[model samples]
Target chain A: MNNADHPTQSPGNVAGIRRQVVLPLGKSIEIAYNSIRVRFFRSLITTLSLVLAVSFLSFVNVSTDVANGLLATGQPELRQALVRAGYDLAPEDRRADSSSKQRWIVLLSLLVCAVGIVNAQLMAVTERFREIGTMKCLGALDRFVMRLFLLEAGMQGLVGAAAGALGGALFALLNGFILFGGQAVRLVPANELLLSLLWATAAGCLLSLIGVAYPAWVAARMQPVEAMRVEQ
Target chain B: MTTNKNIVRVTNVTKTFQLGKIAVHALKGVELEIPTGQYVSIMGPSGSGKSTLFNMIGGLDKPTTGKVYIDEVDVSQLDAYELAWLRCRKIGYIFQTFNIIQVMTALENVTLPMTFAGMRNDEAIEKAMGLLDLVGLGDRFQHKPFELSGGQQQRVAIARALANDPAIILADEPTGNLDLKTGEEIINLLQNLSHERDVTVISATHDIKMLNVSDLVVWIRDGRIDKIESRDELTISVGRIDARNA
Candidate 1:
């Protein structure tokens, strides 16, 4: 280590003028994982909101795909069975189309999910105010603190979204079996269901990042907020 | 270079905090200097600018109207990056709450700052182990903060504060939460550590026990230094000096 500390009380001389390196992303991810595990219940609650919204979307998608596939089969026996099951085959194009009402519901549900995430994260960060202050006092840069929060949120989002998508897809399958018997399983293509889940999961993860953005920024830029607390 | 003896200097420092519509003067042109390798205690009643003064010295918050210098570097001049380096390498903070991360084990908590300073994991672990040993918590390295007693947790916090070998250790009422015996032990540990490491120890404390181990006691009243007394001066003013006070 160089004797880089100049001791002349110069105006611009920074103390301990040595190279500073940030802790790697891997270390932060590890810490974030540990924190989530320790606060498992809290994290579970945050993940639940994400799960509900993503599942709703995937359910709508998979159910539509199954209904479309059954309709597109076009065989008179299957069509007659579909009519018996209350299927409206007229004007139902090859492309699966959910009504505008369902689209509004999806948009509303996702917006609610995002708002829930932001609220939960903000409260969580507030509860960890002292922890954040301690880390800052220990020389954690703003970027490091931001990274920790984002990583934690991202992990929760990923887990919750995948679970929701799978659950919704499975539910759609069971509903299909009950409504149309063996024909339901044979008609619905698996690839469409898979595609719906992939995008649903990605959207959930992106929402998580956007949700955590403000709280993480608030956590990072503080100067050990407790510094001004009265000493008694 | 400034005198090697003085590690911290404060000149005409004032801090005004705006609560709502009015400005609260937290520090009122307070000036003081702490010598290297000395254990100094700052004492005051609540709302007397004790914490504000401490913040200025620690460089956790900048002064509103003056300057604070640590190791001859003007605190007000450094940007955030430079300021972080100063905090990381030049100053160690011990809080009253023993604010060790609750999720991390004692060893991990101690190693955190070192890793932040860019020490490799293996080396950080080795150094952290040595620090825990020094603080007498080597056997409890795997214990989380919740698992440790108040004193033991404080000891871990001490090890953490020393992780980067800071030139100054700022203890904010470190003994405020401990029982008398544990508090005394902590104070003695701090006193000895400062002497051995030749680092300045600055504590904002209410515990009179601190007066025994401290070489100097600074009393703040109403946003200004009321008096500063050497240990010898304090001893004579009260009664005959104790054997340890000598």
Candidate 2:
């Protein structure tokens, strides 16, 4: 009549997931972990697709900008206009002057990170309807529900932000070295690193709130009867 | 006849839900009084407004018409924050599915309401453990809902309902999902809570076995009270076992 009815109670019964693997919040952490893991995969697909799209745009934009800058550098009339633009056929100095291109790429990455985080957070919220409803039935107020989900997003955001910022900085640093070969190069852009980390956290919070709004609203509006009616 | 001693008073309460263009009347002109320390069961077929009544009494929903009073306070008039406070301090709920948080231990589930009541974490955990022990889940304190059987889960839920020392425990089909033997165990637990602890227990269920544990049974048909029967009198009218089947 009691837990003796549980099939999993018997030892040697497949030795499934042990009850002892307790996370800090245990089940909530598992739920959040699973949800974010799934989101991480989905974000991978989204990021890859976005990279392709942005790469094409970047090639076109950079080429066009460089051509325009050089053309503008030319006087109204000049035979050997290549030298007139001071866009030396030499690749070294030209690359150094490519700060404008660096700015454009960084801006694009920022846009991509924003969209990715927001998309991931929104998807996570949509999938947790029953969880949110359960919280509400347990007497969670609207703001309390908001805070819990926001915490979930915050956790994921922290991970994603840290990873993304570190990844961007490391890549930029490596590329700076590669571009300069054995020569001196500013591989550590302290300002860019700081800016990206800040942006990462902000993006995380923003996306999480955006993602959580729909689910939070759904949770707040649930009637107790309706909430309890949800099956596993 | 409303009395000051009534813990819950519903006066001509009505509830309506608008689904797109159609309006659904969940409860119609329902009036009732439940004095303190009464174990009452509400029974009706689907759409009979049984759960609707429980919802209104628990302050989970607002009545479209009339009013709901808890301890003479018009809970229907309270704002969302006020209703939440009342729910935390005065009401406990048990659901058919057990509705225990899946990720939380039995003890944690029991202490959830206290957490909302703003108790310190350690205090809530200690009290929750005490409640779990009281409900016979002492050995299963760290067990999750999925780890417990149906009856044990319901016990955890009962412990949870008693968590805040609430005046009233509102349960919707607390035993509907359990096997007969398990259901009986759950009923016994609830009955003990009502009789021994003097907690006002209001349950909405179709389970005849559950009615055997109730002090009073309120039968509803078509959103109105069809009959009210006292267990002792009903037992006298027909033998105890037969009365339940009847």
Candidate 3:
């Protein structure tokens, strides 16, 4: 056969011979997609749980702060005084409703995310014992194996974080528009959305690492023979 | 590739395993030496510690006592990463189950060890193809492990084991899973490798038919060498010799 027909038969044939034949194109995306596909429903449930939990805690924190501030200022003499002092006794009806809902939503989302990460990592590790072994046998050190899991989890985290942040902000904005009828009810921190995204990603990784620890340990110590013996 | 005369040296090696409360002795004071480019087969019954011996020699397990030296370097003292590196650079391994990664194509499986050895992706892939071609699986590069038959898969495993151009190929029951014809083909291929590549082959097997093809036969019993035989000591041709003559 002609050399042209054999793509792997290049001038650097010897060098080409040594690489792990990773499939070119769509590998990273495919890996990410598959990881998400395996954990999507569970991750949603987790994210929702966490969102609710965090939101509730945040509301508690904010309300407690607002209440203390109002108390410190004593009772406001005028209706506008409370608003000016950042302690509207009546507050806009829509703002009150949304702020209340945000508590539960944030808590729910956080719980959902944490649980989903644990589940996904556990499943991924369980399913790929042989693959891990093969990598080890091929001379992969502990750090390399850990890196693979980290990368996979990191990708999943990015996806989940982006989606949660966007969805959450939209929900918050929708609540504001409906309640205020296009009027302002204090400032909405746009930067918090970015912060939330970053936080979600970091949390996703942290939770996944916790889940992956045992499996990664097992893999790191796995004898090449045991890995080879595992049934597909 | 060190041009070392003594490739593998084993001295007073002992291995034991704790299975619950009982301690199972796998190898006891085993001392052996394998020179470079030797083709040897280890034969034994099940539970005879032949597998354990192979594992130790392949650097997959550390002996409880004594030391293993490959290319005159003591392997027992090396750290995990260094030991892994030694396995990657110095030894090739073939398993009875083929042990080809299911998620990877044949070429990928073959090239995987080189990747761990720090070879670039392109170089490893190209070399993997060449090795596959050498093992007569050139056209099946993209075939996943499950897609191939037992014989085909074993060929892929052989290719994988040879990927790093290691001096020694450690095969544990290489043809134990194949039928008579396929097993013979594998044996022939291994024999050809011994002759052509001058690679040191250490295989553990129960296949009586393989004796004819082996340069040296080591019978292991209770983790000890019962008898060591060179090809000149054998008298009988067990099978197919008369047929071929006819």
Point out the worst 10-residue segment of candidate 1 chain A by lDDT. Answer: A6-15
Model 1 per-residue lDDT tens digits across residues A28-141: 999999999999999999989999898888888887788777877766676666567655556554445677788899989999999999999999988888888888888888
Report the CAPRI category for model 2.
incorrect
Best-to-worst ranking by DockQ = 1, 3, 2
lDDT of 2 by residue, B143-190 (tens): 877889988988998888888787888888888888988888888888
Model 3, span A1-232: residue lDDT tens: 2222112213353333234323233433453355455557754553443344334333333333333332343333433443553443464322322245555765565556566556655666766676666666666666666655655555545555455444544554554455333322233443544455455445544655555566556655666666646255
CA-based DockQ, model 2: 0.14
Using DockQ as the yardstick, the better of models 2 and 3 is 3
Each prediction's TM-score against the native? 0.93, 0.74, 0.74
Error of 1 at A45 (Å): 0.5
Per TM-score, the best of the predicted structures is 1
* DockQ list for all candidates: 0.54, 0.14, 0.20
Candidate 3 CA-lDDT value = 0.66
Model 3 chain B, TM? 0.91
lDDT of candidate 1 at residue A109, scale 0 to 100: 95
